[model samples]
Target chain A: MSLNESLDALRAKMTSEAAGAYEEVLQRLDPRLLAENALKPGDVMPNFELPNAEGKMVSSLELLSHGTLVVTFYRGSWCPYCMLTLQALDLILAPVPGQQASLVALSPETGGRARFVKDKYNLRFELLADVDNAVASMFGVLVRLPPLYRQRLLSQGIESETLHGRKGWFIPVPSTFVVARNGTVAHAEIHVDYTRRTELDTLPLVLRALRQYS
Target chain B: MDLPQIGYFIVLSRVLNFTHAARECKITQPALSRAIKRLEWELGGDLLLRERSLTQLTEFGRAMLPLLEQVQAAADVARDEARQLQTQERAPLRLGLSPWLAFPLIGTVLREVIASVRSTEFSVSVEAEPVMRERMLRGDLDVLVGLRADTLPERFNQWQLFSTGAAVFLPRDHLLAADELIHGSRLAESVLLGASEPEALPERILSQIVRRLGRRPSTPHRASNWETSLQLVRSGLGLGLGLSCWPTPPELVARGLADRLPDYEVVVETIAGRPQSRAVSTFVKLARASAWMNPANVP
Candidate 1:
C-alpha cells in the first residue's frame, strides 16, 4: 500500500475509536447533530469572495486561478488549534507544484483580529475575513455555540463586540478543502467541535493524491 | 491637592533655586515659582525659605518631602494593581498549534482546562509563526507553542517541551526508501510536498536540499494542512518533510535525511507580566506530560 492508503486506514481506525468514545460524550454535544456536508473528491467548488486582513477583496476565481487552491476555514485567530494547524500548513507549502495553488485562510475575524494570526504565527499565506460567516453558512459549516459557553466567553471579554465590534457572537466549524484548477475539490476535512483539528502531516499525502487526479 | 506641584515644591526646596529646579523639571523658572507657591498655599504654610539672594527648605518643607514621597509610592502601587485588574478582566489564553496536532489535542486540552479552572475564563486562539511571537509581544496572547529562539522577549517566560526531528515522507514503493539516507539532489527531481515556508521544518534541511540542487525545487506543491499533505504524498504526487514527534501511518515512510535537521524545540511560553490562569497552567502541564518534557533543558 502507498503512504496515503496506510493513512486512510489509520484514519478509519481513529474514527472508529472516536465513535465509541463519542457514544458517551454525545450528551454534551448540541442537540442538532452536525450536518454532513463535506465536499467530495470531485465536487465542484462554489464561488466565494471575501476580504483579506486589510479588508481588500479576494474571490474564489482569483484564488482558484492557481493550478491548485488550498482553502482553509478557521474559527478565529483566537483558536489555538487553528493557530497550530495553520502554522503547520505554513511549514509545508512546497512540493505540490501540480496545481500551483494559492493557499487562503478565511475566518470571521477582520482587520486586527485577522492580522493577529499572521502577527502572532508569522504565517505568510493570505488570511481573509469571512465577515459574517455568510460564506461559511452557505457551506453549512456554521454552528451555534452552546448558550452557557457563549456567556462564558462573554464573561472573559471575548464577546462579539471585542472580536468584531458587534453584539452577536457567532462561530463556524473549522473546515478545509483542496480544490484543483478546474474548481473540483480533491480532498476536504471538517471538524465540528473546537478542540480537534486536521493533522498537519496528512496534507502532503492529500496534495499528492490531488496531483494524481489532476 | 495638586501633588505634582507639591513634588515640584519638594525638588525646589532641595535645589534652593527656581532657575535650577525649573531646568530639572523641564519647565520655565516662572512656572517653578508658581508651582511652589501653589504647594505652599495648598498646605496653608510656607514650606520654602525664599529670599532674593538665597533659598532653602523650611523645617516644615523638609519634613513634608518624605511624607509626600511615601504617598506617591502608595499611589503608584494602587495604579499598578488597577491595571492588573483591568488586564485580568480581559484575560485571554492564546494557544498555538500545527495543523496536524490541532484536532486530536484540542478537545483533551480544553477538557482538562475546564476541569481545572473554575473561576477564570479564557479565549483560545490558533496562529502561525511570527504572529505568535508578535502577539506575545503586543500582549494579545498569553502563551504559545513556537520556535524557540535564544533570546525571548524580556518580559516573557518559556518552557521547552521537546525537540522534534524532521523526516523525509515517502511512499512505501519510492526508490529512495531502499537507501539508508535520502540525498538533497534526489529530492529536487521528485515532486516536493511542503508548507508555505519553513516554519516548522528545519531550515537546514530545506536550504541544504535547495543549495545542493543549486536552484528552487522543480515541482513544488503546497498543502494547507498536514492531513492534506499526507494525502498528496500517498497519491504519489511528491514526498513530504515532517516532524518525528507523531507516528506516521503504516504505509508512508518517514526517514531522516543524512545529517539531520535541527529546526526548533516545541515550547510553551507566556507574556512576562501577565498573570497565569489556572487553565493555562493545566494545559501546559498536560502538554509537557504528553510530549515528555525534559526539565534539564529548560532555558
Candidate 2:
C-alpha cells in the first residue's frame, strides 16, 4: 500500500480504539485541538507534579523557579533516534549558556524505566515520567503507535516490560521546546519519528528569540 | 564559486534537461545549458542527461558536486576570516564510515596514519548514512564512507563509490533456490519475503521489481538484515536477497545468478568546515582502492 493509505488505515484503527475510551480519556479535549499548536509563546505552562527518573516527585513550578526551562518530549527511551538527539543536547548544554535554561526530558515511561534513559545517556538534565501521557496530552502530542509497529516491537521482546516494566503499548511523538524565564514557550518542534530533529544550530536562534521575549 | 551555477547544477541533476533546467534556472536556456557542460568538463565526471527526458549523474560528477559545495562554503568562510586558509588552525578530522567499511578499510587507514603522524588524532564513528549524516551535520562527524546518501543537508560533502544494487535470497527448499539465478521480474509473481520493513534499499528494490514486473508481490514478512531475510525465506515466507558476502546464513542455501540488476553507487563524504585528519585521509584513500571488493555475486 502507499504511505498515505497505510497511515489512513492506522488512523482508522486508532479512531476505533478512541471510541471505546471516549468517555474517560478522549472527551478531555476539544475535537479541534489536534490541528492547533496547543502551547504558544507567552502561555503559562501548567504547573504539573510529575515524577522524575528516580521516582521522586518534581514539580514544574520548582524547576521553573530555578532558571529558564528547556522541556523536551520523547516517545520513549527505546528509540535510537531519541537517544542520539538527547545525547546531543546533553553534550551542548554546557557550552550554551542560553540565559540559564535548564534542561528536562519528559517521556511516557515512569519510575525505574525512566531512570534508565538518564543512566543510559548520562543525561544531566532532569528526566520526567509523564505517565499515561498526561503532560503529552495537554501538549496535544500523544498518539498510539500503529499496530504493525506495536506488534513488531512486542515480537522483538521490547514490550513495555522491557521498556518501562509495564505492559502498556502506547507512546508519545518526539518533541522539544524552549521555555522562557517566565514559563512561556519560546520555541517548539515536534516530529512523528526520530530521523528528523531540530538541529543544535537551530537552538542558538531559539535562544535569541527567548532573549528578546524575556 | 558562482552561486547561480551551483543552483543550476542542483536543478539540472533533478530534471536532466538543459532546457528544463534553464527554465528552472530562469536564465536563457542556452546560458544554463552551457553552465552544465562547463561543470561536467571542469569536474572529471560525465554528469549527463541521457535521452531527451532521462538524466543520470556519472559517478565522478555525483562525488565532486558535494565536495565543490564544501569548497564554496569554505571559500565564503575564509573570505569572512579575511580570505586566509591558514588563519584557522585546521580542525581535527572526524571521519564517519559505514559499519561495513570501518571493519575492512578504516582499520588499515588508522594504523598507517598513526604510524605516520602521532600528533593528529582522527576521531571516527561508524554508522549508516542516515545516522551518520545526522551526526555529521551536528558537527559530531567529519566524513562518511559507503552508500551514496540521498539529499545531504547543506554544508555536507559526497564522494561516489560505484553503484551496488539489491539481489534476492532464497532457501534451498523453495523452488527458486535451486535455480542458477532469478530475475526480479520473474520474482514479482512470487511472495517475496523481505529481510526488512519498507525502508530505504528494500523500498527501492521492491519498487523497481514491481515496476519491471507490472505488479506488486505480497510481502508476507520483513527481516532487518541478510541473516533474518534468509531465515524468513527458510520459514516459507518468500525469497530473499543476501546483500553481502558475509557468512552462509543458517538453514538456507544461496542460489547463483545468471544475470544481475542495476547497481546502486555508494560514496564517502565529509561535513563542511571539518578538514580531514591524517587518519581520515588515509582511510578515504584505502576505501577508494577497495570499493570493488564486494563483487555483488557472493551469497
Candidate 3:
C-alpha cells in the first residue's frame, strides 16, 4: 500500500480519544508556525552532526557532498505514521538514473529507541538521535507537547526517560527537506498534522531536479 | 588510545575528509564516523570542529593530539616488543572511570598494577556516568570504577570502594570562602559555573540544588569542563562545584557543602558472573589495597 493509504488505515484504527490526544499535542504549537512555510528553496540548510542508531555522528554536509540529501524529521517510534514513512522510504526511495542520494531520519528519541526502530524495519538509511530536538528547533520544526498530552502518553506506558533519555516533551512537526550539493534547500515539507507526510514517489523527481541544480 | 579510533582520527587529521579517510583506512565511512564519535564520547569533548564548509581540530582536539599520538607510538613499540619476545600479545585493559570519582586513587593504583603485572597495558576512558554505563554495557569497557552501588543494575557485581563528601570551589577572597561550608542560599546568589560538555552535572545533584534554592541557579558563565571552570573562576567570574575532585590551586578554597546533598558511596563494578581475567583481578585487588582508599584521604 502507498504510505498515505497505510497512514489512513492507522488513523482509522485509533479511537476518538487517542486521535484527540495527538491533536492536543499539536495544538500547543504557535498558530502561525502551523500556517507558515519553512526552509524555502534556495535557503541554506544548517549544518548538523547527530549520532545515528549505532551512535555514529552523521553530518548533513557529509551526506550532501555525496549528492542530494533527503532528511526526514519524525516524532518518535511510537507514531505508526512515522514508522510507515520510514518503511516506505526504505522500500521505495529509488535514486534517479545517474544520481546519488542519501537519506537520514531525525527524532528526539534516545539512541536505544533509534536502534530499535532501525533494526525492526531493517532500514537502509540512518536514524539519528536529535537529542532534545535541538536540530529540529534549528529547522523550525520543533513543538513542545502540552503537559496534559505528555501525561496522557506517559500513562499509556510510553515513559519519557526510556524513549527520550530525559523528561523532554518536545517533538518535531515531521518534516522533509531535499538538500542539493551546495546545502541549499531544494524542497521543504512541514506537516503540522503529522499524519500527512511526503509522498515517497515524488522524492525521486525532486532528486532529479536537485541533480540538475548542481 | 582506542587504537582504531586513534588510527582513524590520525588519518582524518591528515586528509580532513570522511570519504578519503575511510578509504585510506579501508573501512566504511560510517565506521570511521562511529569510531570518532565513540572516541569523542569517551574523551568527553568534540575532537573535531565541523562547520558548514570547514572541518578542523577543536582546541580540545589539538590538546589531545600529541598525547594520543604518543600512545599510538608506544603501542607500536609494545607490539614489536611482544613479537621479538615470541610471546602472545594481550589486548590492553579497557578501563572506564566515572567522571565524579577522584582521580588520585586510580593513578596510584594503576602505577602499582603496571609495576607488578608483566606486560600490562591500559587504555582508560574517563567520562560522565551515563556514558560510562552505556560503554560498560556495550563491552567497550571491562571494569568501571566509582559507580554508586544503588544506581547500578543487578547485572554488575559492585564492591564498595570509598566514600567522599561533595564540595564547591571559590576564589579565596570571596565572602562565601570565609565559611568552611557554603549554604545553598549563598550559592544561589552567585553565578554557578559547571561542566556541560561530556555531560552536565548529575540530575540528582542539580535537582537537590534547585529544591534547596527554590529556583534554578543562574549561570552567567558555564564551563565545558573543570579546567575551563577554574579559568573562569580565576578571572573572578564565578565559583565551581566539584564534579570529580577539588582543584589543586591554592588560590581557590574548597568548601564542603552545608546543604542536604548526600554523600557518595562509590563502588567498583564489573559485569556479574563473567569470568574475570587474571589481569582484571590483579587490577581490582590493587585498587582495594591502595592507600587512597584510607578513610583519612577521602574529601
Estimate, for each residue in A121-157, the C-alpha lDDT of model 3 and write its tens digit: 8887888877545556556565545556676777778
Task: Return the lDDT, model 3, position B221.
Answer: 67
- Ranking of models by lDDT: 3, 1, 2
Pitting candidate 1 against candidate 3, the one with the higher TM-score is 3
lDDT of each: 0.59, 0.57, 0.66
lDDT of 1 by residue, B1-299 (tens): 33356457657767788888898888898878776675555344577888898888788777666545433332333234233433434334567654533234446556555543434466656555566778778767766765566566676655554566667888888898897777776776777776664554434346666765787675468775567778888988888766665557789988777755455466667664355553454454444333132222211
Write one digit per residue (lDDT tens) for candidate 1, span A62-175. 667667888888877555556766776677774344546678887765324555566567787888766445455545454444445555556656665345322344556677
Docking quality tier of candidate 1?
Answer: incorrect
- Worst ten in a row by lDDT for model 2 chain A: A22-31
Worst 10 residues of 3 chain B by lDDT: B290-299
The sequence of per-residue lDDT tens digits that candidate 2 reaches over residues A1-214 is: 4323433454455544343433322333222432243566666665554556543445566677766677788877666557767777776664354456678888766324556667766788787766445566556455445444555556656665334322334455567777776778777666643345634447767776666766
Give the DockQ of candidate 1: 0.01
TM-score, chain A, candidate 3: 0.90
- The reply for model 1, stretches above 4 Å from the true place, is A1-214, B1-92, B100-109, B119-124, B149-154, B198-204, B211-215, B289-299
